[model samples]
Target: MNAPPDIATEAADHVRIVLVGTQHPGNIGSAARALKTMGLRRLVLVAPQKFPHADADAMAAGADDVLASALRVDTLAEAVADCRLVLGCTARSRRVQLRELRPRDAAAMAHAEAVAGGEVALVFGRERTGLDNAELQLCHAAVHIPANPDYSSLNLAAAVQVLSYELRLALLGAGGEMPVHAAALPAGAVPHAALEGFFAQLADTLEAIDFHKGRAPASAMRKLRRLFVRTGLDEKEIRLLRGILADAQRMARLARDAGRA
Candidate 1:
């Protein structure tokens, strides 16, 4: 009989590496190679400029299996819709107020989420400008790789390789046991899509109640998003919050009708 698979490899199977707006097919291929080398199998591509190109296949080399199974989606949200934990790998911090984690810390967090039976995603952005503020909003946290400040421009594949290597090390260090903090995490955390739905409802409710009062809602919404995401809400908590929002909307509508009367 074949030997059983190791705990680390099993957990890795639940993690997906997401690339957004990649401009080069060769980089995708090289990224695939890097993932395969680190024992990670799943790859998600979001709005790549070119795929199914000879350059990608050529660069993949012996990592054809990883390339062949790569999933292509139109948007980053769609790519990570079902994921319970999404970490964006960025070279530097942006305006978004997400918790920052080093590569090793990120790897450990991702590994813990995966081991707890949740889908995890490590998102990478475009080659030139990196992930935009809107894109960063979808992520629960940011992973920063500290490089020389004078020359911090890292290739997309190189960034992927660094995270992949750290993740592999994290998995190996697990020693076949769940991390202590993993047990404290809420079980059955809602996926990204569900949380997004809540945010949409929240915006609508705010509008109904005139919370913004002719001012731009962008700043308020950004702060609200940071507050809620930091709490790591579960499915039950999301449902409760949505229920409150629905009631608020109804009350606001009634108030408007009374004023008209």
Candidate 2:
């Protein structure tokens, strides 16, 4: 089970590029070109404002196949419904509390997930507004492109190209190895939705016990969510955590009943 994967083949089979709320047809086509250049063929378009236009085909250059085969969906959740790992690309100053990872790190992580026989997604938001806070929250973690501070407004296709390049580099590492920490990562890792559910239950358990004192419970919850994400909880770990939370909730209920009696 420790054999190195055929990086390109695995990436093509398990990794997907998700463009959410794309406003430009050219950008979509350019993103396809980027993915094709990096040997990644799967593309998913979510609620694009403009698509199937002449401009898109024209901009696709020689990579028209990627654009032609791209999957179109209505929402980001739909785009990544089957993916075990979803990494959203966002600017660094979004003020969203997420585990901020660089492009290289994110690429490596995505590649590792793909190698583990799990589907992975690299999500890019709109060209203008980028991913809103809500959309960002849906992702397992956020990738921050560390561009120059003076002018950080990266074009949609350009961002895609940059991340694609990083993914390719990560995949094309020496000796067919994808430079991953497979030993550290847990076995049978759960999907992003499971982690989200755990976070919700954790918050509920905390609230039941009056664990948060301040008026900003959401703030505390956000930090706790980031902490758990960084710790990399797998399916069994998540189940264990959920059991503890349930027990805490039951204990709290008993305490309340005793007080009433």
Best by TM-score: 1
Write candidate 2's Cα lDDT for 1-261 as tens digits. Answer: 223446566755788999999998999889889989888999999999988988899989988999889999998867876678888899864467766777877777876777778888899998888888767867877888999989988999999999888877766663244335432433226777777788889988988898986576867876776677667777788999999999999999999999999
Error of 2 at 206 (Å): 3.4
Q: What is the C-alpha lDDT of each candidate?
A: 0.88, 0.80
Q: Taking the tens digit of each residue's C-alpha lDDT, what string does model 1 give over 16-90?
A: 999999999999999999999999999999999999889999999899999999999999999989999899999
Worst 10 residues of 2 by lDDT: 179-188
Provide backbone clash counts, one per model. 0, 0
What TM-score should be assigned to candidate 2?
0.80
Q: Provide the global lDDT of candidate 1 against the true structure.
A: 0.88
Model 2 backbone overlap count: 0
User: In angstroms, how far off is 101's CA in candidate 2?
Assistant: 3.5
